[model samples]
Target: MGSFTLDDVLAVRKRRDSWWTVFLVDPIACRLALLVANHTSITPNGLTRLSMVFGLTSAVCFAQELLIAGAVLFFVSFTVDCMDGKIARLKGTGTPFGLWLDYVGDRLRVLCCAFGIASALYARTGDVIYIVAGAGVVVLDLFRYINGPQLKRVRDTTRAVARENSGAECVFMDELLGASAPGSSTEEVRREFERAGDEDGRELVDLQRGFRAQFPWYDRVRMFLVAHRVRSHLISGIEFHAAVFVVGPLLGAVAWLWTSAVSGALLLAFESVLVYRAWLATREVARAVPVNEREKVLV
Candidate 1:
């Protein structure tokens, strides 16, 4: 529709991404996005639909026990998945519907892949463990997605209320990290929100206070990771999916069990840390703020 370059696509790329994406997907997605932006009249939703086609096809390949082909197809589907967001951001074509579609599409792709992989494995080995592992993959993915956003909503509402009632000074680290990625400096984040001046400026800081107070070393570790442009979420959904769907397939059948196990453990471990830090922060906030809706629900 218009002239664009690789730089334009890169500029709209996320400030921080899952490390799997940073190392593997973006190098390809960005270039493809550049081509799509400049050449085709294809919309972001169109790309998303195309991605679903590729994704479902990959799932079929897995069901047929074409593990290598399935992995390659899945990777292509994922790379295309990455491009839709960039295209949306660059073209200002983002829609609420698009967000909903992208999210639903991802979840469905995971479910299908899990089923295909599980069925294939079970068919070959007749072992119930493969069936269970596939089901575990689906359940864990659901658990992560379901819990994460709801927890953030609760955290956001709590912090927003606490700030309003306590009349406490706004601090960037606690509130801002929930919205942005976790690696930004305090001053940089403050300046960013102040520049943007949206209501989204500060709502995640409750945990920051308790974290900074209770575990002073955590910030040092986070900062060290930031130096390498890596966010400290060591094992996120992206890594989980890649391990289960891509790396395991490439390595061979037996590898899936161990790879997914290791990745799942890492994911659960990080999730536990987030929960504990939130607990410390919420406990501190309860003492300071007037009773809010969250407290009302508990009572």
Candidate 2:
């Protein structure tokens, strides 16, 4: 029931570490790209467009039965998708417009591949599994959108806490993203820093620098990718590819008996992970305070 703000979104971005790192390695590479975007005045929407271009290519590759190339481009798209918002935050240029574009970009790219994969597999086997997979993809997208409001709340609270107490003493749980305060926004914090003396603002910057230094690059990358918001993307991608492409349809084509067994196993594994993420999202919603409390804090 808590009212929300931009900080909440950023927090979700940070919490991405909780799930994203396990499936992908060297996620820190994403930050390098973000850093470039930040310095260049490239809008988040531009980054989103770039991601879509690559994502479409990735999907096309998959459609043409270019699995390896598709997989490679898909990963590249993921990296860009992950980095764009961070770049926006670093440059203090985040906008609702850009954010909206980013969201649509992700959906377009993901759904494009989902539909392509389903069509391809359907053509090959007519087993209906690919269609089922495509339907699941649609459901997942709905889940994401329905869950987005709560995710925003969680992110807001985390950042508010970070600003109020200072992130230095904050120990981020594996659950949420940063050591953000429960209700603070980036704008509020930036204003606070600006109103203070030059020395004080410098100290705050130094604190931020120190915080970044404390975490090794690998750990940071792991955290960024696994952050709660983005976790589903990585997990879902792996599950779909591993199950539908590798285990189910592919295996079924090669060997029927083994295919059924592998499909069952993969389904069980993927569903379990999906359920866990659902629980995590529920827990985040539970922690959000009432709207009145959020308003008071903001006021």
Candidate 3:
């Protein structure tokens, strides 16, 4: 219940040890780029702006149905996306304002790109379905931003208030460590318990630790899943543009059939899953107990 800062949030996120590196294959390379950027006096916001330009360019290319160019640009844009945060962290210049701007910028880019693609695709094939699908993607992304952390904050604040009023403070470590899963080792759980710093809570910590450590390769798999999923969608989005624009004359009928069937189905499925996960993540975040003591305690 203390006043939280960006540093606190970032530290915790860092501790989670993202498995994205396994899928990215060049996570450290991005980090090194950030280091170079820092030495050259580059700011995180600058990198963020650069990423925006690249993302916008990619979207423009997709709208024009320039398949190869769009594909290359999209990846380049994402790579730039990876660098912005690293530069911020490496230079120790992460700011609340900057973070907010970056978050909003990403959403804006998504919305704009969707509009652009829809417009271009429509112009080519005169199909309303392409526009609808593009709009749906934007809506899904918007929902993710709105219902994700915002909703989670509401849930957590409510829980914290309820527990505190009842003379009980919920500790996240207690819940995380105590969680049990099948096929976990004992020693691994013990270490996690020790880290929690409460003898009474050690048992659960040990168990949770065991489960996490046991799946050493799980992070890699998870990252692979994320990259594969993202790349697949990117391809689908591009293909829709292709069929609607580039091949609209020769493949108009076939393209409409495929776009309305394949891309629509996949996009819906992915969006549904993403929305559910976003909701769950928000709820979990709302439950996280503040650990630092320097800030004023809300409870």
Q: Pick the TM-score winner.
A: 1
Give the Cα-based TM-score of candidate 1 against the true structure. 0.86
Best by lDDT: 1
Candidate 1, 219: how far from true, in Å? 1.9
Better of 1 and 3 by lDDT: 1
Candidate 2 TM-score over all chains jointly: 0.50
| Candidate 1 residue lDDT tens string, 154-255 | 566556666776665334374354345556675576667656545544333333666777777766666656555556777878889999999998988899
C-alpha TM-score for every candidate: 0.86, 0.50, 0.58
Candidate closer to the true structure by lDDT (higher is better), 1 or 2: 1
Better of 2 and 3 by lDDT: 2
Worst 10 residues of 2 by lDDT: 202-211
lDDT of 3 by residue, 162-244 (tens): 34443333333323322423233334444554556464532221111222354465434443334333221233333333333
User: What's the true lDDT of residue 134 in model 3?
Assistant: 69
Per-residue lDDT of 224 in model 3: 39
Candidate 3 — what's its lDDT? 0.49
